[model samples]
Target chain A: MSDSPIVNEFNQGPISCHAFNGDRTELAICFNTNVVTIFRKSGASWTQTSTLVEHDKPVTSIDWAPKSNRIVTCSQDRNAYVWTLDGASHQWKPTLVLLRINRAATFVRWSPEEDKFAVASGSRCISVCYFEEDNDWWVGKHIKKPIRSTVLSIDWHPNNVLLAAGCADMKARVFSAFIKGIDKKPAPSPWGEKLPFNTLCGEFSNGAGGWIHGVAFSPSGESLVFTGHDSTITVVSPGTGDIQSIRAPYLPYLSVIWLNENQIVAAGHDCAPHLFERKGQQWAFSASLDAAVKKADVGFTARDTFRRMDSRAQSTTSTDTEVHTHHQNTINSIRSFSGTPEHVEQFSTSAIDGKLILWNADSISRGLGNLHL
Target chain B: MAFRKIDIDALEEDAFGEDEIDFQEIGELRPVADVDAQVNSRAQEVRSLLQRGNTSGALSTSLQNPPYGAPFHAAKARNTQTVMEVLNSIKVSDVPQLVKSLSPEEQDVLMKYLYAGMAAPEQNNSGHLLAWHEKLTEVAGQGCIVRVITDRRTV
Candidate 1:
């Protein structure tokens, strides 16, 4: 395994969304466009295998379920399609999901069990879509009470019944996405005992009230951490009503995922992913995962400097456009590329620069010296 | 086919219906208090602390319970003036020491006051307020400024 971060410069437009298959061989990415392109990993490089072209507008989010080998892509065209590989033709087939929403579908995620998926939309509601065997197509059930604004991001509880949504209204909420026929009566969790659909389990504001950009459940689902546009990461424990908010120094984060029970990785406008860890009882900023080395002032000897000063009438080179960090732009999405929820060995981050970087958590732990993941 | 841009405000009105009252507007509505007695007394207390040369105490006292949720604009203005006076009186070199002495929550409150003071530059000394802003952010990190911006309650 490579200790250094593997940077794949796809050079497609900004990758708005991406997902990896079970063994991390194939990748599904949408380049802020209408089509979803699949790439088969070949050594250090990737070659495009096929494209899923169903959505009329830009695909906003994509989730590839590992166990089921099904890829779900949601788009601003207000539709979601589940793509399955066909054995006979060696091609992928798309099954359209009836979202029943008039506005753009912003985000989508398959539950841990891969039985149902939740699609967050600009219609101020969440559509919990599940496969209906009798109808032979996926159907959606709307969860639409008390959500005042567009739902930005949603995460599934480990139990697959409770859904946590971060909204544009600056509220992070927990609601029951429990479907009668599709879901089994979930075991009692801190959220609630009742298994009814659209039950408002909990509602929270990140103290100062910035739009919640990203939300994620802890490995155990006992706690939820959300990043807000106010540059604050707030952790909520519904069982204890314990909420801890940390204001980060960097620009607001757009996406966050738990590396393990105690460690969380979040990235956004700062163009670097930061690690936040739960120390003792409080969660605090640990370190930046991007160990960006300052660019050395190379080839600027005294003679060269004098020659350049005489010619250009400038003391320093002002045209160096490269940012020292690996990802040249905002990293919008981060996911566990390998390992279990309890211990994510490696994780991947995709940025607006159209570069996908796979980072080794173990190497980061070693690099930090004192921080042990 | 030519597509027309959807008016999000109109779309929201259609989805939720025009009769629905905005909860935020309702939250802002409250019975106006007639007297500015509490605000006046607090400002007086802060002024006395400043007169005693207890700059930290004056700073803390001024930050405590800034007037809000009322139509007491004059009282709020008076309190802001008093707070600005306390801030301006502090020595620039002594800022880091004063900031270090403040608790985490107190530091956040100071940041809010710093931002509030900077808003009215003509009344408050921008140089002094900017120095305090530097010290506050140094101790509280940028999150304090964010907290102040996001917090609906104002000084």
Candidate 2:
């Protein structure tokens, strides 16, 4: 509940932010004005790394590659652009532009392997593109049922080359990638026979009452959970085709992430982040974040070492004090939280109010820091 | 005995006198060849009519007094069985409309058969049948009867 300048000002504006990698070293912020700013940590201070100014329309979604070397941003201009940063110069530049989409691009995410990325457009199609090193760009994969209902969210499986896409039609489809041999010719009837390259693994009705807004695969990749316009979370076992749905008290506008195997953190239209734990038969809310700590993790500590002069004793003393740092901004999105023995340092979140907050997982309250926009 | 063998053969021939063989035939009941001829002609006429694409009229005429090789009746029976298999796979919600389209006699037969298939073994025969009938009535509604029939006149 510490009131910082970052939170107080962000309470009045609309912005989107994402922390890159588990350490949250790189932060990307997309503003309402259609500009993206990248920030990196230098010493104890955070500084601007680069500003991406390519999209003519407002940016709808932005995602950092799992490697943190590249960023993908999609916009209403019906285009998705990939931006890569130079490690030596700390400069960011757009390297690839995907064009000729039928509708506005809403969301984009890089796959877990960092070899491919998926983009969801308003035209109800999710296009997955693979990066080719020789060509230095992305090429679209052949997809069946190219035109479906509008896709709301697309997420890649944590362990395999599989993708889960949530659509406006209240259905979620799982797509898996397989490599066909070279010189393979197209079959006369693509739909009649199963192709050798790609496979539609499963199509299930997402029991959430309304449009599917967000979908995420657990780190174990055993189950997939999705939330939608309705205030409910549906968990499906991809292995067994079983569905278990839970109702959340508040409607979630954004997404939910698995904190561990059994715990989940969900944030959205609700001002506070809700932490839920799966019990024997139900999901119970374990904790709620403070209004300012929109997307704070459990660990982070900031330590300052300095020499102080005592006025009464007229003596100088050196003291090292450690303070738990927690993010003090409205968190719009969060990714990756890893715990360690000495310190947990891999949780990051973005704020709409113009702050990119990073927290150490071990001591989130004391180890929090922010990169101002 | 050897000396008497030749005389014994001659005596045996003389002892068995030949009887008179008379060949006399009278007409009793005659088999008719005209019946086979009529059947062959009728079959040819039916074949010609079928080849001319007058299957419905041919079938109608054949149904009045069927030809020797009428195969349409057996094919229709097979079609009914196919429809029943398809209906069995349909969801419960769709079964009522499908059963409604059937004729009243077919509806009755299907209802009885389905009820028998679903009835529990321990239940009384009458009770199970009544319960199944009630359920079918609920699904099929009033004034509707499932019927499956082969109208020989129309065939």
Kindly report, for each predicted structure in the order presented, the TM-score of its chain A compared with the true chain A: 0.94, 0.72
DockQ, every prediction: 0.37, 0.00
How many clashing pairs per prediction, in order?
0, 31
lDDT of 2 by residue, A1-373 (tens): 1233222123324666453544556567676657776667666555776779988888888887655577888888887788876779767778656545777887888776676777887775677777666787776654446334678778877533667777766566766643333223433221123434456756655332355767877766777777665545677775555677554545353566665556566666554455666666465555554333223332232211121232333232222221122333335576564553122234445555454443333333332332111
lDDT of 1 at B118: 82
Predicted candidate 1 versus true structure: per-residue lDDT over B8-110, tens digit per residue = 5664444642222223422443333533676678878988988899998988887776665446577677777877888888899988998888876677777
TM match of model 2 to true structure: 0.54
Candidate 2 DockQ vs. native: 0.00
Worst 10 residues of 1 chain A by lDDT: A364-373
In model 1, what lDDT does residue A371 have?
Answer: 52
Candidate 1: tens digits of C-alpha lDDT, residues A159-186: 9899999998778999999988778999
Off by over 4 Å in 1: A299-323, A366-373, B1-35, B68-72, B103-105, B148-151
